[model samples]
Target: MTDDSSRAFVPGHVTGFFSVHEADDPEQAGSRGAGLTLSEGVTVEVEPAVETSMQLNDEPAAIEAVTRVLGDLGVEARVTATTDLPIGAGFGVSGAAALGTALAANRTFDCGRSENELVTIAHTAEVEAGTGLGDVVAQARGGVPIRLDPGAPEYGRMDGVPARSRVEYLTLGERSTEEVLAGNTDRLSEVGVDMLVRLVEKPTLPTLLASSRKFAREADLLTPGVEDVLEDVADEGGEAAMAMLGETIFALGNGLTRAGYDAEACEVHPTGATLEMD
Candidate 1:
């Protein structure tokens, strides 16, 4: 009924992603020029408290965003979780956190917002935070996401990479989402929007992802190493592409085999994030 309600929840997560159509430079990505859905299967925990106190890193913006959404719903709860990843590494960390909080807080108050509604709220928070152009949508709706228009911020679900595809990911490092978004507005344009629309309508999901990856490389967002890695993987009988921003890259194609990639090279993750009540 209110923030005082005693309940909790945790949700699942996956690293779904929305592709970027052009090159992102320092002037655009602010040092972290790509976007992605970070760690998936994130676990969120909630507990009933006299008042709502969200415990997380210094993401007051996220706290504020969730609080505002919860306030609108007249529900509240104690929110806490693992040290959240950077805001923008192209991972849906922001959406995961928001959705996790919403799921947790929903139980705390016995509120009944549907998953769709919660996702909508999370998207609003992401917009308010300005960490992503469409990470919320991809995170919320999983799978390969294709945003036809960055202006209206509209997108739709895309099929996963083909089952027979051979690919793996490589982690580069970490970067803050906020820092990456700091100077990216100039790169956002109608042309990028059109490119996304075309990709989404591609005959196959794999084709769509491959094309988008090429576009990213042509735009110069994909570093030499990143491009080299992709080329190596693809030439080695696999297709490799940047995952989210730069923190990681995933290889895709018919010839890729799990054995082809070094398990020790990078951590494998479920495709989405999750939350739960303890």
Candidate 2:
């Protein structure tokens, strides 16, 4: 810990495609998908305090995922999370904050929890909060994660695309995930399952983006701006797709720039969430 406070970083994840699976148990509820872990994300700082408090981007807030972790650990602390990615824009900012909180709190209070335990805690917290499904697990593993099974880290299974490259994204606006998940998702799941199967067979970047575009079309979650940007990127010989549950589109490498859009770019994070060393 640094000066009685701890800090952690969690890469933001962009799920290309996913099929949700709910259960009575939060730990057993999650989604199966594949996505890239961007280097830009949320960084959380934790300090033991008399009463628990939280601030997001310098504003007072009660983030449910952060609160859930503190409550589950039976500790009172002040949490401050600053997000590099757009909030509620499918960059997995909430999940990043949740995972970062777990990592920082574990060090701040000396909870002595293992990596998997912390991940499970964050995953369960996200599911319980209705903010996300597989993002916590993807942020925990980094890279291009292929979620083969649905659940928390301990119960779920994942694989990777085994490669890395740049990612470009542009967020037109924020979108709430709860409404999307609460609505009927049978068709979404069906298309997602098929795309996942195809990805599992190929496990390449081209296949991932191709399958993701198909999934997004089948799920009917693309905005006009997103669709236009995708077409432009493809015309420039680059692959792109809409980020699930958000009006954001991400392209492989320099796709967005080549398409003449001013986009935020970053590489796929090589590592997952961890305590930031002083």
Candidate 3:
């Protein structure tokens, strides 16, 4: 029962700190972290086709997460995704694409899967692809998500920062998520565990930022550019830290601008992924 077409939008997510968890089951392999959902993100379109194909921003490409979703759902379709955020910049672009594709494909193929099932499929695909850990769950719930436990939508537990504020970011360059995820992560994981515990106890944006700064320093994830930007922000009485696995910096309110950066700005999106009905 193929439909005419389908579309979905998923918010980009920026994780401040996280600890890795792995399992034989992909659904159970996720990270415990805190992150914010962005007002800007990816929009995906699905159309029935003879063979499964995909394009990102009109360029023919192969995204592991998207391919995994299509294979899992057993559907052949043309998937197109467009986003303003730079790929591999810690904005969860791959996770967003996977979630968007899953949501759109489910409708296009008339699959009777529930929302939980869709999230599970996407989360598993992201984990298997090594593109992300907690992004799927955070994007699934939106807002400032605090992932307290690791897993898929069904297995993972989450809470969020209650207050919303404008978020600003500066993208210095791309960092391969897969490469970082594959490397030694002992120190980073330890710092992430500590930060997650602190956040769960307090559950506030200020705590998230403060913990992020410490994690960046303790985990040694901060690049020269990120460190310089962070210092500048601190001098200006603003809080800033490196986005996980990317040469990017994110801060609260107008922190980036106040630090003399021409950064991109967006609000804290209150919702997660959604199918565009109209």
Candidate 4:
């Protein structure tokens, strides 16, 4: 019998990073950051087949993640992935796709791996590929997740906002996360650590957005386009912030349309990844 499984996960946007620390184990090394998972995300399908293959949503990191998971599980299958959000737009598409693939593949192969175990697999894949840092962990827990500690689910500590809020985002363009992360992060890390501490102390959506905006300016990550959009969004009485590692702007309200930008609206997803079998 061929087993088929499908899973859904939320996309996350990082507010800032505290530090990029290396652990005794490579998988445990990551950045402490604050992020939130939106309702929109990627869905993955896994089915037993003669050969193992992956069809990702134009994310090369997903190829490494799927291949690694299938190799570890000793299962051969065809993996298909799709997403509602743009890849590399700081929406955690790569992390979501990896996490969804891991969940669905575990069920499809009847591996009986725990959620934490699956999360670790996905996190390791993302880290190894340099595609993401805390996104997998944040997407795993959903909501406005704060990465108190870095690493996979087992080593990382996650907290979040208890309430859901409307989220609107406009994509200006894409940025290379690997390129950004590889640059000297001394200044960025300092500001990020401070912002993360403040956000954890309060843990609210407004505080998150405000802190994100501050981080963007302090870290010098903002572009002229993003600045223009933010100015227009403010004029329309909305609070907006740039998505980490991307040129996209995530706003708190629906005033983006009035600013001449098309906004995609969603709610803060309250839960983590989910799976289905057929």
C-alpha RMSD by candidate, in order = 7.0, 1.1, 1.6, 2.3
* Two-way TM-score contest, 2 vs 4, winner: 2
Better of 1 and 3 by lDDT: 3
Question: What ranking of all candidate models by TM-score puts the best one first?
Answer: 2, 3, 4, 1
lDDT of 1 by residue, 1-278 (tens): 23343322222222223333322221121111112232333445556666767755533334555565566567655666554343344445555666666666666666787766665666566555554445544555444434433321223333333222223445566655456445553443333444455555653545555654755655445666666666666676565566544455665433224425452222223243343323
TM-score of each: 0.66, 0.98, 0.97, 0.92
- Measured by TM-score, how close is model 2 to the native structure? 0.98
Better-scoring candidate (lDDT), 2 or 3? 2
TM-score of 4: 0.92
On residues 20-124, what C-alpha lDDT tens digit does candidate 3 reach at each position? 998999999989889889999999998888998999988998989999999999999899999998888899999999999999999989888999999999999
Model 3 regions lying over 4 Å from their true place: 1-3
Whole-model Cα lDDT per candidate? Answer: 0.47, 0.91, 0.90, 0.78
Q: Report the error of model 3 at residue 173, Å.
A: 0.4
Across residues 93-199, which tens digit of lDDT does each residue of candidate 4 receive? 77777788788878877799998998898888878777778788888887788888899977888887777778788888899988988889888888888998888
